[model samples]
Target: MRTVHEVSGLAGVSIRTLQYYDKIGLLRPAGYTDAGYRLYDDTDLERLQQILLFRELEFPLKEIRKIMESPDYDRDRALEQQIALLTLKKEHLENLIELARGIKETGGNTMDFSAFDTSRMEEYAAQAKASWGDTAAYKEFKEKAKDRTSEEERDLGAQMMRIFAEFGRIKDTDPASGEAQALAGKLQAFITEHYYKCTEDILSGLGRMYAAGGDFTENIDGAGGKGTAGFADKAIQIYCSRRGAAANCSMEE
Candidate 1:
């Protein structure tokens, strides 16, 4: 685990900015020391890398959080878009460099200003953002959430956590057992009822996120007991596997 100071140094992000991120629920640390110092683990660092990439593409922090928190968020897809955007940025810079050289060589007589136009980059970014937000599941979630009050949202969140608390009670048993599988089904149904349709692919992605060692893990473990997130993830994996959806449920390190 790395301290906040170490992470700030390693990531070239100011400590104040990191603190602001934590405050805004953007990038939470893994844990805190006895003395109250924030500590980040490898998973946290990976999330930081994603945030940095999105920032490089000029995504607003609010948009970044929304995109990353989406159930359908795919790291590979985000990376591809980032690569494309960065390539465009690189090409734009090269054009500006060539333009500068031409102007210098022409003794400031060159009237070409096309190199300063960033419409292509701006349009591509808009399309990318639209694509991220255009998923059916995302649209459904927004529709469901649009009418919810703060109290209703909190109530739903607490109800879901209570399901994890149930998982905590049986976490020590075999995750593939009938009871565990039933609980996993219950959780899936709950998500579909309250949020978006929880397809096997989406559930598997959520399972990975639960044990990915960040706020989701911390919150689940807190609701249940220690290791509850991993237990639930295993149960979810087994549950999905039995239905021939295992191909989408493989856990990654």
Candidate 2:
């Protein structure tokens, strides 16, 4: 058994936070001492670790409590699920890096959607235009893309998709590394080339959109393999941050 202070120091959480967790029954103590001090056991510490992990993932307190208290709760299985989700997020970021690279090399003129359904390109374009049509950048994107032939669009889209796939393979790299940042820069350039100027304002909005679920997220995730959208969103935010632009890096959807 250990005191609240010991648990706090070990978990790196504040004494107040632990106290509150106990008060709220989010993490009750294993027992109390004769002196009225709170104490926790190994099981309590393990449960605390799970709570912290869920917190990192931004799960609401209530949601985390419910999940942890569920009769079906299995710590090992939960950890596996967490790992899979995090891995998907990492892959998503890597895909954005690759997509950005393609944009830099080809000036945002390629699209490789082999991993995606080819029939969905038109649908995606329509949805994109509808989503951002009111923006000046969307207008510019339409004008620039208007003259491209169907075959040209297909080829370009395919190439871009291939880049996203490459990112998924390299998702384990540091997001702030030269390679990651370079990919980020490429992504910004790609957006500026194909869509709009991609200013910090635009980039921030796009980042949120990528993280937000829907067709765009689906497109990137599908092409890049399950987590590309979130990954791209993070890379874009990092890229914008490096440029001293306002960036929202929250993973909350």
Candidate 3:
């Protein structure tokens, strides 16, 4: 076991930060010494390493806690994501260095700004965050899914896909039409019932994800047919905007 001071030296984390982590229930030492000093064992150190990795990825502490405390948290998966994100960061830095050298060689006349483009890194980080499920909705989802078997889970997923198939049937219609909007409402309610509380904000985010051209898009399209994911995203955006406006009106009243 290592004392708090020893951990601070070894991990390069300050004693105060470790104490704060303990206070916030983010990390608890393995035990306490007779003199009330914090004592951390190997397992505790391992958790701390995970926490530090998330921190280096710029995750908020609360989100990190939610992710690490999640029932579905997988250490190997987290490590893989961390390595991917870090590699992206490294490549980004290298690009900036190359751009700097170019500028220095050209007497600062280089007009190219491609190195400043961080869209790829940011997109990957967002995807990583979503995969980590570092939100209240994910926590609720974990609670709701904890007792389900694999077959049951598959059934639920298939049911959800049927909703997308409905979206596919209406892909040719205007997104703001009553039919599309109603379908969007149905999708929101279904998610709320089976997954988590699909608030307007969360639903809007999901809409974007559906059309983001990755697994979500592929799976949604596979369920609903071609262009279905984009159609659903459009409908969801309209639904969420109208709902948000109504909510604001109610608040004002």
Judge candidate 3 against the unseen true structure and give its global Cα lDDT, from 0 to 1.
0.88
> What TM-score quantifies how close candidate 3 is to the native fold?
0.56
CA displacement after TM-score superposition, residue 49 of candidate 3 (Å): 16
Per-candidate RMSD, Å: 18.6, 18.3, 7.2
Model 1: per-residue Cα lDDT over 47-146, one tens digit each: 9999999998889999999889877688987876677677668878999999999999999999999999886577557656765787787788889999
Worst 10 residues of 1 by lDDT: 244-253
lDDT of 2 by residue, 1-253 (tens): 9999999899999999999999889999999999999999999998899899778655678877777776546677567445544444455566667777887999878686433322222322233323323556657877888899989888877766766666555556666667666666776777787656877656655665555555556777888777776776677677777676333334332
Q: Pick the candidate with the highest TM-score.
A: 3
Cα shift from native, residue 54, model 3 (Å): 9.4
Candidate 3 Cα misplacement greater than 4 A, ranges: 1-71, 74-134
Q: How well does candidate 1 match the true structure, expressed as C-alpha RMSD?
A: 18.6
TM-score to true structure, per model: 0.54, 0.42, 0.56
> What is the lDDT of every predicted structure here?
0.86, 0.68, 0.88
